[model samples]
Target chain A: MTFGQAILEALESLNGNKMRSGLTVLGIVIGVAAVIAMLAVGNGAQATITGSISDIGTNLLFVFSGGMEGGPRGGPGGGRSGNNDRPLTLGDAEAIADPFAAPSVELVAPVIQGNGALTFSGENTTTSISGITPAYFTVRNMQVAEGEVINEEHILGRMSVVVLGPETAVNLFGHADGIVGETIRIEGQPFRVIGVLVEKGGGAFGSEDNAAYVPFTTAQARLIKRGALDEVDVIFVQAISAEAVPLAVEEISNVIRARHRTPIGYDDFTVFTQQDFLSTFETITGVLTIFLGGIAGISLLVGGIGIMNIMLVSVTERTREIGLRKALGARKRDILLQFLTESSLLSLIGGIIGIMFGWFIAFVVGQVAAATGNDFVPVVGVDAILLSTGFSAVIGLFFGIYPASRAANLEPVEALRYE
Target chain B: MDRVIEARGLTKTYKMGEIEVHALRGVSFEIERGEVLSIMGPSGSGKSTMMNTLGCLDRPTSGEYILDGESVAEMTDDQLASVRNRKVGFVFQSFNLLSRLTALGNVELPLRYAGIAEGRREKARAALEAVGLQDRMTHRPYELSGGQQQRVAVARALVNNPAIIMADEPTGNLDSKVGREIMNLLLNLNKELGTTLIIVTHDPNIAAQTQRVIRLRDGELDPENNETIVRKK
Candidate 1:
């Protein structure tokens, strides 16, 4: 028989038992939908994380006052390990800032952070306070939304003036705007509010809008003292361009190594570029995507088994019909093709519908994520769709082989006599 | 006479577990082209076995059997299928029409297996017309009466225009009136188309309508009951 005739026969048989065919197709539908939705969700999470990480200025390098003993650290104020490690000092930051010593370095902002409770009138909230210089805004991509930023005079005169991040401002005072001229007591010490930073969204290390900034000299002289008076916690180094990040890292590493009197490869500090963090996150998320897709593939396999089961039932039920066709001179290949076509057609139909259902699931997930103030959007790629549908079709054909062959190998006389 | 079938000492043996049952034992017969013949016997008389062998549905154990000038006894399964498609048509007692298809679709099945693509609908319609089922071409088996369903089967059998048509108790499911009508239809179609017809029946009245009758008492033909009827032209 021709392929067209086989298709027609398959369609008729499947139509004859609509309930059974529909139930069989539903198995594949759920399998494909799960695969697509799971994969899309995985991809979306990866995109959001990487997007936020890349948002943190790809040209910047972070230098911490510790050795590279543990795995790569995330954000600022990570753990410091090893007894041989020396604290990062303001002198090292100044040296790295010198254009002659580090040509690729555009700016360096030394930071000393401590947690302090700030009170405005009766309302009080505790948040991390960072001591930063004028270059901190440029290096960290921060902006002043109200009043003015800390100037050179504030650092030279050791003025007790502070800048609040948007979230911190909202917590201390009623709102971010018009809170510049207000005075807030930090650790029971009165400091005048100088400015409020613009709102920057959350990232890999949590929300950036939850801290307050003060002048570096004021913090070093009056607050946050660790080892030396000029000791700093971390230094934010800005490269001339994204391509110069490696050069900036090398120069900063050399300057710190020389200052700390450490041998090669045994430095007292660690320097990390944005690319390092990006690759680490990508590897983690890529594996997660595959793992989730693999789990969803199990359901697809179950769906294929469903197809096989239904096909077997159909073959047994139509034994007499098979005998009749054979008696009418139908070859073995014709019977095989007819049954295979039925199974494949069932799965193909299921695959198409599953794609739509999976897309809907992904869309709903994205909508829910956005509603909860999350910067996540599920991404359904064409490759995911194609992979699932093609895999389902192949699964149908593979599982159908046993039943179709069983039908084809039937003896005409015995099949006719089968009741 | 142009011979359409030649059976020389045809024998068929079956193994029912440890016991051997000889279904056909050295039965020999020759059928001329365009002749109407019948085989009549009671249960366990090897009448079904003879019909199966003559219809090319099964091979004899040890015999040289030829149908329409082709040796069919030693043909492979696929080759036998081809031979059945090209040379033999069958009308079953239960009217083995596909319930899902209409009369025309059932009639077109043989031509489809024969790989004839073009004019299939016309050829099927013509065969239905020949069987007086032209008006019932679009009716499914469930929608037609028993006689009409048998007529559709007859149309399907004749559509391929094979060398022989084998009817195994064609009128067994119908009442006497309907059975007589079906017998007359088969005999008339044989005379009109000059196609060799073989009917296996237990009814002597049905067998008497044919030009020749072969009677079997056991696995072998009974010569005493075997008779040829000469019909007045």
Candidate 2:
């Protein structure tokens, strides 16, 4: 018989026991629906998590000075920074600024921090004085919401200038409009505020808006006393091109090592690019998605097995029909195809309903989350739907085999005699 | 002068647990077209076995059975089903019409299997009309009388336009008057279609009506192979 004919026949035969057929197909529907919903949700969470991480700044790289490994694990003194005998000083920072070797290198800053109590009017608040270059604004993509950032001339001429963070300007000046060209006292010294950073809602917890930026020359010459402790805290390198960050990091590490004349395995620093940071978040979120999907997959497996069991029962129940079909010139392949088609159709129908339900559920969850002020959205994409639907079809095909074969192999006479 | 049924050294042995019971001995015979042949036997005489083997439902143990210049004894299962669909139609005693279908649908089944195109419904209606069931075209099997169900089966058998109509005790379940009516229907079909008809029964009275009668006793052919096909194993 033709495929259309066989399909119609199979469907017509189901009406013989309507209730049983409905109940049996219900299991497949539930299974396909669950598989689609869980997979879409899992995929949605992965996209949201990764997008949030990337928003922080994929171009930002982090390097810490007091890292372990080469410093702590070394038998003797190794790198200049970690050793008690050798310290990372201004000279080591200067060597990484060889512009001829790294033409794309834009700015390099040596960072030093000191905390002091500030007195402006009756308010005495303590805050960290961050020493950085004028180019630090460019490196960090900071938008100025005031008069202007300190220029490169100010750093060279040792001019005393300051920039207020968003929260600091709000707290110190109490101007709801804007804080610009304002003076705030720092450690019994008066400094002119030149700029204010645009307000950025703080990440996770602590507010980045509550900090302040001042040129390194001013901080070293006027505010903090230069004691015998002239140790540099860290080095920030900005590449001229974002694509050069990895090579820049590699070369910077090498230049620092050469400048320090460090021994093997005792370097007290870690150099990492933005991609490393991104991958760290990727690993974490990827694992989370797979774990959740694995749990959902268990249920899918149970559903497939359930279908196999029901198909087996159907083969036995329809033994006479199978015999009659065989007697009417149906090939073995025809019988197999008929049973397989039924299973796949059941799964396909179930998956479509499940996908629609899942998308709606995910959308509702995103709306509720945004309502709660999280500002996060759930994303369900075409790839997830295709993956889940394809998997459902594969599950049906694999599980539909045994019963189809059994039906195809029955002896006509014995089947005809079935009670 | 085409012999529609010819068997040479046909044998069929059935295994019943640890013992082998011979269903048909080495017997041979032939029957021509348009003839009504009957096989009459007592119980355990292997008449059903012979009927099954002839119907391509079971293969003979060791034999040469030829039908219309084709070797049915060596045909594949699908080939046998093809022969059944194209050349042999069956009418059983209990009326093996599919119960889920209406009368029209039941008659259309064989043609459906044969992949017949449009107008199957009209043709099935015509078949039902011929069976004297035109008004009952939409009735299911359960709603039909015992005799009507058998008539639907007859319509199903003729729908494919096969060469022969094979009936196994066609009136065994009916009363004498109803049985006679069924017999008349079969004779009418033969007269109209000129189909070779084979009937198997235990009744000698039914056997006497056939143009030729073959009898089996204890799985062996009776002294009747002179005119009828006697299949033995």
For candidate 2 chain A, which ten residues in a row score worst on lDDT? A72-81
Error of 1 at A390 (Å): 0.2
Misplaced by over 4 Å in model 2 are A14-31, A56-58, A66-98, A109-134, A144-234, A264-267, B118-122, B138-143, B172-181, B202-209, B222-233
Kindly give the stretch of ten consecutive residues in candidate 1 chain A with the minimal lDDT sum. A70-79
Query: Any runs in candidate 1 off by more than 4 Å, and if so which?
Result: A74-78, B227-233
Count of backbone collisions within predicted model 1: 0
Interface root-mean-square deviation of model 2 in angstroms is: 2.1
Docking class of 1: medium
Model 2 chain B: ten consecutive residues of lowest lDDT: B224-233
lDDT per residue for candidate 2 within A1-419, as digits (tens), equals 67786667667766566676566655555655555555556666666655654554555544445445544212112343433434555665677678865554667766666776665687766777777776567666677776788778878887767787777777777751355655678887877788888876645214667777777878777765543355555566677667877777777777767765667765556665556656766787678767766766676677677778878898998888777666555567777888887766556655676577667777887888779876556667677678667877787778888888898888877887787
